[model samples]
Target chain A: MVNRMILANVLHRPIRTAVSVLAVAIEVGMVMLVVGLCHGLVNESAKRVEGVGADILVQPPQSSFLFGLSQAPMPMKVGERLEEIPHVLAVTPVLFVVNSVANLSVIYGVDMTSFDRVSGGFVYHAGGPFQAPYDILVDDVYAKANRVKVGQTLNLLSHEFRVAGIVEHGKGARLFIPLATAEDLQGVQDRASIFFVKCTDPAYGDDAAQAIHKLLPKHSVLPIKDYLSLMTSNNLPGLNYFISAMIAIAVAIGFLVIFLSMYTTITERTREIGILKSLGASKRYIIANILREATLLAAVGILAGYGGSLIARRAILAAFPTLSVELTWDWRFYAASLALIGSLLGAFYPALRAAQLDPVDALAYE
Target chain B: MEPIISTKGLKKIFRIGKVDVPALRGVDLRVQEGEFVAVVGPSGCGKSTLLHVLGGLTSPTEGHVLVDGNDFRGMSDADRTRFRRHKIGFVFQRYNLLPTLTARHNISIATHIQGNGFNPHRFQAVTSMLGITEKLEHRPYALSGGEQQRVAIARAVICEPKILLADEPTGNLDTENSQIVLDMMRELNRTFRQTILMITHNLEAAAVADRIIRMRDGRIISD
Candidate 1:
């Protein structure tokens, strides 16, 4: 511990020390940004899949084929027959189309009553919740973009619709309406894209979906949980590999920044380290000193980055308001990981050289 | 009946890339309790290496250094380090005080690290004896070279270590400062019966000690 106190003293180099701290802060900031984006991606996918919350979605096999082929909607009859399933709780048929509500703007529609049961609370940023049929619920993102507000009447597809609420969900501009209104717009049999079903018991969802699929061999029934899980799990084929590659790149960049900062600091303080070793200080003491400095810098850097990322989170959400951005306060993860990595990589050469310092040669070094 | 320090066939061979430079050859030396011995040598003549080996600052490539009948070689590095902290005190040419710390704190750190209880009375006495009382609160950079060396000496002896090893304590100072440092070393040897081994290239400095050993080319040439 001879040079422990001495090495602690040297951590106060004004400009160099601040630059090292900022380097750590920048690395942590970048990491926060990446983690936040990943969370946002997962959240956005889940919100979109479960948006109108049907326990099982029924679509005509041909309709599925058309949409799968050209991203087009199926005729609205498949939703009409889904109520025949024994376990079916509610069958809210949704007509998917890109059509204007009178003279105002293009909108997407879902059955109001079933939408209320499932994805209704997904829009907490607007006026109350969806109530009456033909009462459209617009996503807050589109509302802001179109400068529309709560209780405003919007015309779509040669019909007048009142804006019941503005929802903040994950991605895409959606305007929901009743199945009845959608049928009136496009002639009952030709407009419904999918049927959204809610099972009385959510746990029996997969079985109910299977039974419904068997009932109508030409129709596809998809459970909300299955669809949402597939959309959100991140481990799809090559997706995780891509995300892993990106994280690896971020971490590599962080390591380089920390290494150079610590290396430069070590080079600058070679003489001081030498002098301390000569004063009966052990190699272990010198290494511990460097570790302590790195840990301290990492702590400050992580906190700064976290605070800055909060502002960044707000900005990103504003840019893509449909996204449900998840911000985790798992500060300990970042702090501990950065501290361990910083000390491991940042203090390696410096501590080695500091330990290997021959007091006789070190004293003579100018 | 006991010598405070003794060494037999002490040698240090430094391996630099391919060449083995012998820093110290087989040498025998003895210092009785309370004796102040000065080792004088030319530059690169191995006196400092001998002091280092004797004080347990380093292990010798060959031979044995015995302090108070315990062999320096038999102990582990950790045990040796504790031995060095409790039994040895070092004073170097450049003072080697940490520039960021005040003189009092510098001395206190060495004492504290050894787990030696702080004696405010001893602190006051040591600072007064070394004539560093007024400069105790000042950092090394703020003090003169002579004052800094005095602080270094205070740091070394504060722990009441069994042996004091000073390497060219006044090599960076003027004659007046050198005299002041030497006078303090002599007073410490007299008052506390502290065994002192000082290494220097200056014969004038070595002459003040009770015994003088001269070394050349890593071997003791005369005693």
Candidate 2:
């Protein structure tokens, strides 16, 4: 009966209930978007790193594997030296460059022969293998978005190149060209951004990375698995804090809105609360009534938020074709729980106030 | 026989800006079990305050209240709340029925708060006796004043509490409705053998009770 009364009370003022539900829904939606974007970025980064299929990445000492954009480039000769080491089957030197057109695009320049030996060769959707110096490869998503096709010429850093092939999505970089061509365009000859070292056995990746670290004591040698762990765990500099702040802000918005709404509701029902007390309602009974109302509102908000987030993800992907926004079940469950917990916390004080109201004074309230 | 409701030298004071305004000034009273007692007084004569104290809604400033052999002063707030749920029923002048619930739900809510699920037999008997069985599905707004009050009465007595405290139950009703409500209360008192303490200012309404206690300036003047 108390539960029914609570539901009826929530429906009693439809406008207020709608507003509260909307507020919670918006907060949950925003949190889901933020969390989804973070997870998508991490997952995509790990995929790209794993796509390299290298046992170890050797870069400048202070460089980060997250962006892979280091001002100081490593010498291409480092690959030859790494290949001389035992258990190192193949070595590929790649140049990482960021091109600014309408938006920032990451470009990878690789020696096709050794790159394919170290990393499994790319699977082409349109055409196969680069034949000319300026032949380029693009992912399917990028190709579709940019309307690029085989036998079409595209510009990269004021240099024109023919589209050699369109690879499957998630295969490699959005833009890929010959290492010599990238070196010519960037005016950085005989130097590469990083070295990808493949071991004879996949299980020897850790040993290979340690050996590389010893050989090139001045440079950084990181195992691919470690880089992935760092990205997923949010241990990268300032990333964890940024995600935490976004989550905190989302929870605060939900909590404050629910708290104010329930507090005002309790105040408006002061006389009714007194009447309940006079009817032999315990404090727990009163609290349960208020919380039941809040929980119902939160449940509606959570469902709305989940639906809204799916639509938002589609809209976002359509607007920004290059960006990845992952809406996993884990994140959806997390968003719903956060909203419910925030709303319950918000109702706590108001429920307490209702329970503490003096029956005589409350009944006398006009 | 021991009194169902007893207060010894009960006093209640309201503090307004450091001024202690006495509402119930050291009044001792008792009503035997199964008796319908009416307290008649003018506005501000402390009849409502006395009722509030007796119902355990408010505590006395300087005296103790013993209802059905349990001292309210010896119980904590939570304990008093439990005590009231099991032992006391209250009817207010405003008809205090939850507007969002049907008459049946309002009546059943009392049993719910008492931690007992609805008893269909007692509910049917009470609503049938109060002549509100046909109006059970209607919300309070759809009911007439007399019907609303009867629903309120059914709600108050549904749990079969040991004592019933009514604060001006008919203060807002017309003479016809007031008489009808008063007659129902008298019938309920006789049928259930439950003690009832009512506060009112109407002499005719007081006539239905087994005894009338009149008050003046927060003190009983005539019985």
Candidate 3:
């Protein structure tokens, strides 16, 4: 019967209940989307780097692990010296340039022969590799997202280029331009931003990386697996703090809305409290009733948020093929726990106040 | 049998702001088991306060009230709540039913609060006795003044508490509904031997009880 009363009470004010549920859902959704996007971008970038088949990565001094974000190029002579390191089978010097046009993209400038020697050559889906200085190759995901064909003309970075081929995704960057054409466009001749080194044996990557560090002490040389680990949210600069701030904002929104809703409900239902007390309801009973109602609302909110985030993730990936959003079970559990704990804390004061109301005064309330 | 309820020099003072205003002053009372007694008085004459104190809804300023052999003065608030759950039932003016619940649920909630769960047998008999078996499916807003009060009465007695305390059960009812509710109470007392302590200002409502105690100035003037 107490359960019946609780259900009846929750359903009594439909508009209020909906607003409370929606508030909590929004909070959960915000937290899920933020975390998903952060982890997704990091993991996807790491996977693409691993796909390049480079056993060791050589970057310029003070450069970010994010290749596209760094524009400072090292001398091409550095690539020649890197190839001389013991156990290094091949070295591919590539220029990383950021193209901020209709979308922010990283255009890889590569010498096709050496790039293929270091990383296995691109798997073409349509046409062949670039044949002219103005020619470009796009990955399949980019092709599908922009509806580009092998013969399509594209204008990027204020320069016109024809799409020579569509290649399979997960090779370093979305758009590929020849090394000479990239240097010509940037006016930085004979310079490369990163060196991708393939070792004779995959197990000898650490030795190759240690040799490169000794050769170029100022540059960052990391084994592929170690570099991938550095790309996670916790290891990335400022990302963990950003995620924490977003989660705090979501929790605050949930807390304030639940608190106000429950407090107003208690005040409006003062007479009802009196009736329950008159029916021999204990203080613990009253507190439990309010808390249980809040818990039910939070539970529904979590389910909605989980479903909403999944749908949103799919829609986002569809709209932007190169983008990824990962919604893992661990984060889902965390979001649910955060929302439940926030809602319970929000309802605590109101529950206590309701329990403390004098039966005589509550009954006399207008 | 000893009186099921006994109050000696019962006093209840309501402090409004700075002044000490007394609602019940040195009132002594007794009601035997299975007796239907009426407490009648004018407005602010402490009859309602007396009912509230007897029902354990409020504490007395200075007095002792023993109901079913349990001394209320020595009992904590939790103890009083437990005692009220098992030993007493209350019917109020204005029907005081949880408007959100159906009549049946509102009536059955008493049994639920007592932690005995629902009693289908007692519920069927009690609703049948009150002539509200058909109206149990409706909410309080859909019921008439008399129907709501009857539902409240059923709720009060569904658990078979030792004493039923009613504060003007018919104060809001029309003539026909008032007579029907009073007759039902009288029938409930005779059939179930239910002990009823009803507080009211209506002489006609008090006429249905076996005895009437009248009060004035917060003290019993006559019995």
Q: Write the per-residue lDDT of candidate 1 for residues A70-179, one digit (tens) a residue.
A: 13355555555666666777775556555633322234566555556544435457786556766877776668856788888987665677888777754222666766
Report the C-alpha lDDT of model 3 over A1-366, residue by residue, as the tens digit.
667787898899988898889888988888999999999988988998888899998989998888877757999999999989899999998898789998777899999999999878999999899899999999999999999998989999898999999999998888999999989987898899999999999999988888899999999898998898888999888999999999999999999999999999999999999998988999999999999999988988888888888888889998887888888889999999999999999999999999999998898889
- Residue A198 Cα positional deviation in candidate 2, in Å, after optimal superposition: 2.3
Q: In candidate 2, residue B62 scores what lDDT?
A: 78
Q: What TM-score does prediction 3 earn?
A: 0.95
lDDT digits (tens) for residues A120-146 of candidate 2: 888789997889989999988888888
Sort every candidate by lDDT, greatest first.
3, 2, 1
Worst 10 residues of 1 chain B by lDDT: B76-85
* lDDT for residue A98 in candidate 1, whole number 0-100: 56
lDDT of each: 0.71, 0.87, 0.91
Model 1 CAPRI rating = acceptable
Lowest summed lDDT over 10 consecutive residues: which window, candidate 2 chain B?
A: B72-81
Which candidate leads in TM-score? 3
Which is superior by DockQ, 1 or 2? 2
Question: Scoring only the second chain, what is candidate 3's TM-score?
Answer: 0.98
Better of 1 and 3 by TM-score: 3
Error of 3 at B159 (Å): 1.4
Candidate 1 overall lDDT versus native:
0.71
Q: Give lDDT: candidate 2, residue B67.
A: 91
For model 3, the stretches where C-alpha displacement exceeds 4 angstroms are none
